[model samples]
Target chain A: MTSTPMTARRIRNGLKIPLMLAPALGLVVVLFGGGILVGLGQSLGYFPAIGLNEFTFSNYTTVLTDRNFLISLWLTFRIAAVTTVLSSVLAIAFTLVLREKFAGSKITTFLFQVPLPVPHLVAASGIILLITQSGLIARIATAVGLMDTPADFPALVFDKGGVAIILTFLWKEVPFVGLVILAILQSVGPQYEEQARTLGANARQRFRHVLLPLIMPGVMSTSIIIFAFTFANYEIPLLLGVRFPSTLPVVAFREYQDPDLALRPQAMAISIVLAVVAILLLIAYRRLARSAVK
Target chain B: MTAVSLRHISRRFGDHVAVRDLNLDIESGEMVAFLGPSGCGKTTTLRMITGLIEPSSGDILFDGESVLSTPTERRGAVMVFQKHLLFPTMNVAQNVGFGLKMARVSREETAERVKEILELVDLPGLEDRKAHELSGGQQQRVALARALIVRPKVLLLDEPLANLDANLRITMRHLIRSIQKEMGITAIFVTHDQEEAVMLADRVALMFDGVLQQVGAPDEFFRTPRTTGVARFFRNGNFLRGHRRGSTIHTDVGPIEIVSTSETVEDGPSVLTVRPEEVRLVNEETDQENVVPAVVTSLIYMGSHTQLTVTIGDTPWQIQAPAAFQARNGDTVRLLLPRGHVSIVADDDTATTGSAEATLAEGSAVL
Candidate 1:
């Protein structure tokens, strides 16, 4: 009876397409779906390995109300928001200026894209070495007598404000976003701007009304990726953040590494919350992009 | 009154000259076409007029007022691009009303005029449609409407119909001509199509190699192209090497009577040109002053007319006759080169003169 049904379905829907896509689909569902399910299960306080199998909302309640956890969440949001906004605005302005061909434009473009291939950790360290109190800039300033010593330089790295983390993000992500927007601009061509000019739009009006809307979708998508990466990123904030209030990812890492195994549920709960926030942001981005295109 | 005058306008990019010293005076409410091949400076000239491009040297005047320093947005001369550059983010109504909004026209007045122009372009009730949703012809109509809604003093079209299909091109040609006439706006159309230039413009200015070869009425261009370059560009006449002797010219085909536009034909070689349709085929025994005896070489049946190739001595001539006038190869015939229809272009440059002499030496004619 099973053989007959299988044969009938095979006749109705051919085997070639399904057979070709089965491996990729199976791997994706097994890895992604299975991982999410385990995380969700653990977040609800279900852990059979350590003999605690009861599901409860206690883990979520405790994690959500903790003072340190709340501060970490807020700090993460602030860093990501500031970094995304600054990067997008500066990238757009840079792209606009770079769109015009001029002397040394090729060299400028090459230098702008150089940071893109470098790892985020490398960029974070580079920023530390240049802007820290005893770093290169401070040493140079002290040598030039602008400051009496390296300690006289203002604080930029490892501060409570996460200034170095944000600066590192700006240095790295600005070019990534700018390059995407530039590709769109080049593909869309300059004819539209010329047409707008003939239709009596001034330079500012043309940029606002013509160029901005055309590049918005690319900008929005890249911005969402940047926001999610920075929000959940571990290394940059780990290397540059202060001890008072760390990013959510750093707090989660500390919880996961705790010697007390009962803290596993709390760590999983924090990870689950971070994943939820990311999913919500992705949904919002999709809606925003749809409305923008329409 | 001249609406726009381009006095000795020239544009160069680094070392390459795009447009030479072009002088043209466009009368008020008259439509003039800059006709040329690609890279012949037609578009460059249009851009200069619209102030999108500044000439390397010389000035453009609008009604005797120099507009060399005026920005493109304030020049009051709008252009419809060859490719429909409709803003993909905007709907038809917004695109058409963009200029008015920029000019600070009241919202109510802008909407009213946008509606009026859309109706004029036969695109009513399409105000809400995105530019990407419109068809090619409809997009072009929106572009035209956008340019026209501004009420510009001079309208420029940079090969606007070059992207449309053949049937739509004809319809658009008629529509654009009608709209321009109804508005009485001074317009300049740039096109590479000779037929389009002749059919649509009050006067056709032919360009070759960044220079204006001739500017005259459509029929004037067909009747008498000023130089060998103009004749060659139009592709409507057959060029042959000839020597003018009084009121007649001697060619390899035979002696042909001609009407010389020049006061006196120089003793140097000349280029003779005649339209294919003007080369008449007559009875073998007909007594015509410029008649030549020849044999039918080949015949092509065109829809409206039949094209016949006849050989006289060692030269071949193309003659167009009614499709019903049929003859097979090897049949003897008589051809007449009408005196009034023949044009004698003086060989002014070595390039044209060398090519003309080469064609005569080859013992075959180019159609």
Candidate 2:
């Protein structure tokens, strides 16, 4: 006798597709949807377990009027913007130089990809150690008679300008952009470039007309992602950042670590603001991408 | 003495020789195809002609002036690639105007020329459509328009129809031939498809193993191929090992009559190549003098004609017959190998054994 019933068989076949998709759906809900809900509830100051159960706008107001909020936000935007622009230009140059066949192309490509696998914190520390006043650069300067002492090294690291932080981001981020754009460049297929040459486009014209537009999507998307990552990053800025108002993520971390439990919602509200900025940037990027494709 | 001439052209990629001591002269207003397999230096030859590649040692002259030293941009030659290379960001009109713009042509003239070229390509209103938005054939038309708008001295096409579907390819072949003929511009077409070369080119330059096997009219190359490689590349040709006795070459099929210019070498072992269409099928009892007995192993009906695989003395020869011909599998028939036009070349025992075995086992192999 068959142990499987007709109804059960029909039900099993009907549930097969949903069963296969269960893991992905569960991941989206638990990770993304759940995080958003938790952030929203905490931002509103309505968490019951911690005994703060009131509907108020104080968290948002505090986050907005905080002493370092505006400066940190501006600082973060400036650093991210500079890093994206500089890295995108450098990545495009690097890709063009390495696109053709040469003796060192493979080694150059390998070296560019090496930074991508390195942890961001590790890279940050490496940059700090190399560029700090008491670090190897200053030591070399002093030894080479360029400076009288290591303490006389210029105050680039941990300055109000955030030059050191931007440099650190560029050092680690440019290679990622290069690798992504390199793959895009390779997939573009050289037929178009050859046709352009035949159509009387010189090297510059070919780059502007054929190769650049084809690779623009990869460049823009990678640039936006890098901008968001550098802007929201906490550890690198916290370690190598100046004593004054740090980035938004650093400010949020300080609030989160404070002993007073009531300030946790304020930090969560700041995080929610950062998340909104990121989502807005993403939406703008998608719109730009659609326009470019058309 | 010619519109395009390559004298003793040679290209070496590191240690490997791509094209060695190649010499060719194409007349003005002639459409010639550099026909060969993938790596046989046909593309390298075209690239040299278009000034995209520099020959290792040679002088390439167009209209009695050396273009070998000229850069690609100043050579006054435009190339249409196998894949449509229309600018993705620009509409068809902008792409067609790109070359004129590069030459610093005025905006009014560029616009007028772009319109004229779009009309020439039969794509008048398609000027506003982006390259990707157009169909494959339409994109190819744009590519052609973009190249021809420059009004170059010559047009070089690198397998321009290789990317299209079968029907589109056939249609484009006729279109390109008509356009090339109409424009009276020196055209160089590169392709590995023999049929395409035969259909499009006024003269076909058959290349094999990085050397020019023969350069002649399509009928000459088809009827009197200078080498076994050329005959093999053309179609389903039956090649039989033979021995030369005076002016005749005796083979398994029969003795083939031939003429040779080189009389210094004594021919002991040779090969005879005959195309399938030259192989006639007659009644088994008809005792034609040049006929060989064979049995039909398979019959394939291909719209215009029927292709028969007939086995004769352990070797299967392809015989093309009319579509309405009465023929079926397992029918005994007598096959005739043409004696007068059959090609005979000295067989290099080492080189051909491998390629012949490989070519024999290719899709139409018979047991």
Candidate 3:
């Protein structure tokens, strides 16, 4: 019974974070949370300014039941999954090579990190200029006599496969994953690898049993952020994806920008749905990541 | 069992020679200690045996075959590091069984061997604990078990007991020696402390400035050290400059009689020393063959013994006397330098002391 009242020191410890967070959290709550509240209110069909004062479930039902919703969801999921798997795998492989110093290793590490600071928009633009049918690679092929003309080059950009979108995301996110894991590898030092060598683990076995399990935690956590970003990011998919089956963010964004304001609730519903999916993904990734080493 | 040998092997890091002309043969199933001060190439020699660091010159042989071209994993010369570098992400059983798994042993066999080795190291039923969860001593046992599971041809230890506290270090030393003997595995341990070297090794190889100064049984080092450098390293402080004639060394003061336990030197100019612990105090009424008249200049009353500094014919000598003895500064006493404890060592870097003394003699002649 006496433990019910916290001691002064305990009370001080409890208030430490909130007191520290109070200053920066004020503007963030108003600008970020305020917008989410407005979006939620509208998604529930309670936009009084639009002459819809009654709270209802019609907007959610409409967004859920729409036939193209599934296609948009599939496109978003495919792009995010493919980009994440490829980039995470490539980052780990490249980081392993970088960790073992060789000729030109420093230069290779410097070039691998060159894409890290470039924004997603810039990456998307670069991929467009270099990979589109009449873009730089196509012209180079034509000039090199591999193709008769630039138009003869295969259709790469604006394809139904969403290759351009995945490429752009990979370009931006692979370096992020690599940088995080590389920093982790540096902190871990070289003695563990030397110890493994002395234990008679060959190169492949060392990587599989020792190095992989050690660096898995860093890779998995960074890859979660990569998945979320690639899933809901708007610009890369908007510029690279086809119009009919674009990622969910682009579709929701398109609906939000429509001149007819009644579609606002549908757009807000899609936004809420996207947030819910991201949360589910966060939970799913943590579960998988925790068991990966074992 | 593997008879590991290094033949004229040397390692250089850029221009600095880490190990120069290191030649040693470790017999199969025998344990040898590589003893040296820090930076004396002992660790470098151990790493070379594991093939972790390539020797810049010469060859390393296992069972009389050159293993210079073999990679570390295939060499079967496993090493236990000072930090006991167990894999951080692995549990105890996983870490211990990793080597067996690499050899493509079945899961059941690996498990059985891991269990056996863990019990041997006295950490039973700790299979599921993570590496970080173990205490420092427990981690070292896991490391030893991990190396032993593979049945390495030669086991190398690079100061593995260096990180432990005093009590734990003694326990680990006994555990290591028993395990090595039980497995009949050839082993080499590198350490800077002479006591540990003498305690653990069947034969101790002393190194100095990237060279093996001497190699012998621990007792032989105390009885018959080869050179002044070796004698000075063992703290043999009472060097008498004399001419050798049988067991007698005629110094400036008088002919001091000694009985060397190992070898008799050729009749020539000699420099001899005895262990400080072998020197004893006697009264004026006693007469002895090796007795030399001395005066106590200083004394320090350590708990176990009183350390006394005495001078005989202008040369200071250190002696460890019984702690309860009544001796004071300026007391004239007769000290006995016992037979079978004094050794005649060869002249090397410390022979310059004789030349410096000759210059003093020359100055006295000029005066």
Candidate 4:
């Protein structure tokens, strides 16, 4: 009763990180948890603000079965997958080439990283201006006699294929992923490569067996972040997307802005589905990252 | 058995030359050590031999054939780096079998050879452990096994044991020497540690400032050094400034007759060097031919031997005697410099500085 129990309780209390993080964690739980709960309730058709207070799965059923929503979901998945794979491949290639300390390497590295600080919205606009029909390339092509008119140029932006969105994501994400991989490569250094060469490994063999395995974890983690970010991004897709089959976030926004207040639950339903997909992706990413470390 | 020959090899980075016009022939199955202090170009020479760095001029030949245009993987020479650069992602067995896999060896034979090499390095049953899970010494053994599994014709070791503790360093020195002998590979060991070089190599090549200072057997190096630099490097004895007159050299200390064995000794501005163990302490008032009267300045009691600093005509001289020899500070003693122990080295202009004198003082203090 003297001092032992007080000291013991204090030491035991020190082990609770959640208790220590109550201030910030509590705010996150309230804001994010409350927002997610509201969305789930609305997605389940329980929004009392519009006087619909019944707990039903009809909204989810409707959204899941819609042909337009299905197409939008497929487009989102395709864009995320293709963008993640292509950007990561290009990033790893650029990182390997720029790892060496050659003349003007400092300037070259600076140039490579220049796009990182730029906003995705700005990069999307830049891509549209350069490659969109009736944009800079079309004008230049017509002036060079390669095209008769701006309409003769191929459709690169505001198309169902999402080519401009993919290009914008690549422009922004490749350097970000490349910088991360470059950091890991620099930390591991050239010693292992040299050792592998001395052990009779050729150039390709060294890259495959030595450098690739060493940088896999960094590459995977960065790719996961890029995938999640691009999948959830609303700005790039909204700025350079067609009207027929839009990305999930764009469709969710359009439903939320509909004049019929009764359709708000449909917007929340789409939002909930997108969040679920992102969470599933996050779980998969964590599993892949843990295995890569091993 | 392959002899490695470096013919007039020189390496320069910009205006700074790392190794200058070095010509060395390493006999087949011989383990030669490149011994020098840091920044003395030993590692550069080793890397050049391993084909990691090409020479700025001249060429390297393996078994009398030029390997100048050969790639590093095809050079048939492997190097153990200073730091243990074991593959972090692979376990011990996988790391050791990497080179074998590169050569497309069968999995069964690779596993068998990996096990055999792990046992040879005394790291048996550790094949499943990752590099970070093992200790420094164990990681080094894995690196050694990895390099040796390739069956390279020449082995280049760059300060392989420098990261280990003193006891482990000694143990690994014997392990490397025995393994090299057992494999019968021509080896080049580059190290800044003189003791390690002398303990392991068949011959030690001492270097300084991009040049080979001396190369000989360990015992020959200690008994007879060719220059003042080598004498100072070995910390053999007191180097006193002297001038030759006939068979005797006149110095601050009394003139001691010397027998000139070097053809380059020409009777002007020579330095006399004698080992501390060679200087004999005799009874006072003895008038020997090469004996001089001195007073003991200090005595250091080492475990097996006692070191004495004695002064004769204001110049300090060091002498090593048995621990039982009794002498106190300020005691009068007679010292003899035998003609065989007194080596007259060519007086280099670089060795006559206050900093050099300070280094000699520090060296004698350690002795």
Candidate 5:
């Protein structure tokens, strides 16, 4: 299928538009659509490489019955719940405190929004550098006689407590939530607030009645996304999470990377669990979006 | 007791003066309009009284208490905005009951008060409907209901009808006036529309360039405008330049009688002002002096009346006459200018010449 120059030119120009769109469309299909299908198929135990020819419920039974899997799932839920609640409250408070114009409003707004575009791995590492006990602060403390030695520095990350992971997520997610809410708040013009003030609403009353309801949908939507991301997120958990019976994503990643090919089906089973939770979060997000009339 | 008063009030926005040295006294229950063009500080003045914007200097006293330092919520004022600022999330009842709920009125009282105010604004059974579900006019009614349910000492209306269509605006203007009168609340309406101001306000205060040009009853403001700025806002007024000669004034259009409240000063060229309605359209047989023979160049049919554009001695003038009047485009007619309706004004350009044009400048001269 060759063509004449005139026909070739038309064909070339016509193909260019779809060709330019092909990469993004292919990424969406392969990364999102194909990944879900593959994960679903493997979860049912149809993998030829593992010598499992028929679809079986063994992987799912294993996922549901394992005590370690249950603990990891529970821990992930706790971390996500804490992170979402703390991030939403902190984000809204931070936005309200710096919403009005002041000397540092623009800089503060930019600083809060800047963390949103940064990758999760980068944000996790940044938090680790500051908050980890054996990090820079611990070295300074040891040198300044505040601590006797480096080992005396208390544990913040790399422990089963999961507080460090929650804090890391909050440090990243609170600002992201703030930025999303600030965009909505900027459009919620001061006219409504001013009108409320004249109608005898104090500052707290204005925020509670007028401002909060207007930005609630944005906050809820952002919370759902953050919850989904933190629940199945591999990087933050892998980098800072505990080794034994860690968060769901970290445990699932370890099983997937194991040398035993038989264990890969169980990893797919865990991925399937993550996918279900993420999908439910997505559904909750859609409901929140629909409810965001104001 | 006066309802609202501003003494030596001025507001500046980073060197740009929005309102300057304004002293106004509004009696209790009086509806006054601050009418002017955009950027004339009418809305700014209203907001200052409502405490939405603080004045740079001077004081705002509401019911004899200085509210200058008070926050907007504590000022005992409520303002209805230009657009429907109803809470989209809340239903009509909740939005109306917001202030009461904020003031911590009991839930039972809030519900009863919301019901009563909704009925007062003629939205009797719309307590459960969302604000977005209502029409523009209905939304405005809800906003009014919301404002009045709180029972503030004063109500401020910032061009409340500016967002509605023409017919709705006219209907709402009457409805708002009736509501204000019924509530007997001191309302300060801010508008750039002269017709809206005239129809809604018991007294219209004309403002120009952030300065109050005249404040009086609507009839008085129209009858004798303190300045050309005020006269220009109402409609076409015939401006004839002339110099006073003792008891009478002589001009290019001819001479008319002069009875001034001010004492006689140096005689100079002055402007005599007469509205279009004051110019009588006489038939050929009518005996009237100072009749100018003119040709009607254009005719505008305005429903009940026809506006005639006539050229009288090289100067164009508009004459508003009833639609039943016998007049046509390009018709030659005699228009009489009587001495009773005309007032004199000095040339503001020569005002710096130390009353050089003050002799004939009588009848509320503005210099």
Candidate 6:
């Protein structure tokens, strides 16, 4: 017990902050960071589990040159773009209503926040039950004489446009973004709006100049988070997208489960490309936000 | 510029009356100060003029036309608040030019006018600085420039200098008075500092307990007070309880001469008010109308003047004398209470005493 351990004492005294942070740092460095490194290695065609030991760029070359991959990329971009734009715009409108002092507004605000804790996969299943071709709405329409048969109902899920997937995301995400903007609106509440009204600004001008600019940081932050999450999510699109030209996540996940082991490196290559593109888009948005706030 | 008028204006919040039936006619191109203690309805009246707070029953007219139903933006009346609420996201130039931007003025003209206004407020070359980047005084100057840039017909200032330090408060008072006069803009300001009202306004309107007590020029408040409450508010603290017979007040301190006008009854129980500064310290009882022999009881040394409390018979009187005067406690002295400075007024015991105590309690808390 009297013998000194120099490195442990040094860590306790001199590197106190790093020692305390080791637990969180360990998970990030060992799990996600290590996983990314492994993916990067295998993405160059070095999958040791299947006994292929040579590293090559052939996997990336194969995926990048595929016409089907290009079609999938465009389709995924449109879905994420439409969902995020609609969620953000509708969220601001919802926040404006929530800020009013009408009857039952407090209960309504509480109800709006209820979807925040729900899982995205659960929301997709709910969408399937309600709006798909043979789902509740279609059966009700058939009964109501609006449709002659279940097949006569429009195909919302597993369709080329991916309407059901976007609807699912909107159902969950509008509240998420609305609650963020609502917090900002409540904190700085109407002080600048009152001043603007006295300065000859009409209702529309007050919202455009004062309220919108004041709450922009919150809106931009939530929208970017939603875009990144929806871009990389594989479950909803796989369950609700077309078989041909599926999104990048679903296509990569399909390759991951294939019986042929040679396709393992292709899955890793596609995932690495997806992560890099999401980061690049986020960087562009950060630049846009800086200029807009100024 | 516009002449503003409030006719029979009153506002009630539930059971609490904020501003009672008030009528005031403000001339065109004049500056007026709504002055009172806290909870005195001055600010409520000011906000009513701006149409931000509606009166329960009244007609507010601008340039002889009813503006009670007109929207705040269309009324051409802008308010400068105590907090100097510059938009946090905008730069100095953008904040100053906000009114012009709303009016759809050309960008070049807005920029040019913003620059001119910044110079007028003595804060030039600060166009790009954000609100947090400037000092408090500079931010307030920008607030003034923002309100002035639109050439609004009526300017409403709600305690605009109440948030500043003592020295800056004086500086801003002069700046506001000069700007209001030079631009020939009809302006109304609300403040609790009587000195500020007296210094910056063409006329002072004093309120108490949700009711307007008096409105006149600054000197009129001192010479011709309408009631005892007005006298005590301005700290004209020499009140002698007496019985009035014709023009003289008979009290324990002998007959105090007064120049009673039409404001008081000819023969009745009364109270007389004389300002402390009007009383004089003398070596002997010269031929003065209200000279009295008294013994000094207490004295407080205020720099320019010394307040001496003296007892005549069994009653005490507060009077101010020169700072260098030699006087001690229990010293016999001859005091001259001037005749022309005395006024007989209605007793303030009839006014709400409970509200008066509440006002004093709040004032002490603020101090």
Q: Best-fitting candidate, measured by DockQ?
A: 4
User: Which portions of model 4 miss their true places by more than 4 Å?
Assistant: A1-3, A6-12, A285-294, B245-247, B259-264, B312-315, B324-332, B350-367
What's the ranking of the predictions by DockQ, best on top?
A: 4, 1, 3, 5, 6, 2
- lDDT per residue, candidate 1, B229-283, as tens digits? 7876776546666666677777766778887656766644567777788888778
| Per-residue alpha-carbon lDDT of candidate 6 for residues B151-189, written as tens digits (9 for 90 to 100) | 988999989998899999899889988888899999999
Model 6 lDDT, residue A56, Cα:
95
True contacts kept of each: 0.84, 0.73, 0.86, 0.91, 0.93, 0.68
lDDT of 2 at A143: 100
Error of 2 at A170 (Å): 1.3
Candidate 1, residue A200: lDDT: 92
DockQ of 6: 0.68
Root-mean-square deviation per candidate: 3.8, 6.7, 3.1, 4.3, 6.5, 6.0
For model 5, residues B143-223, the per-residue Cα lDDT tens digits are 999999888788889899988999988888888888888878888889999888888898888888788888988887666
| Model 1 TM-score relative to the real fold | 0.93
In model 2 chain A, where is the ten-residue run with the lowest total lDDT? A285-294
TM-scores of all candidate predictions against the true structure: 0.93, 0.81, 0.92, 0.94, 0.87, 0.89
List, for all models, the DockQ compared with the true complex: 0.81, 0.52, 0.75, 0.87, 0.74, 0.68
Candidate 1: where is the Cα deviation over 4 Å? A1-19, A285-294, B250-255, B260-268, B328-332, B352-367
Task: Give the clash total for candidate 6.
Answer: 0
CAPRI docking class of candidate 3: medium
lDDT against the true structure, each candidate:
0.88, 0.82, 0.88, 0.88, 0.83, 0.88
What 10-residue stretch in candidate 2 chain B is worst by lDDT?
B358-367
Model 2 lDDT per residue over B249-342, tens place: 6666676666554655465566676788877877757755667677789888887988888787677678788787776688788776666656
True contacts kept of 4: 0.91
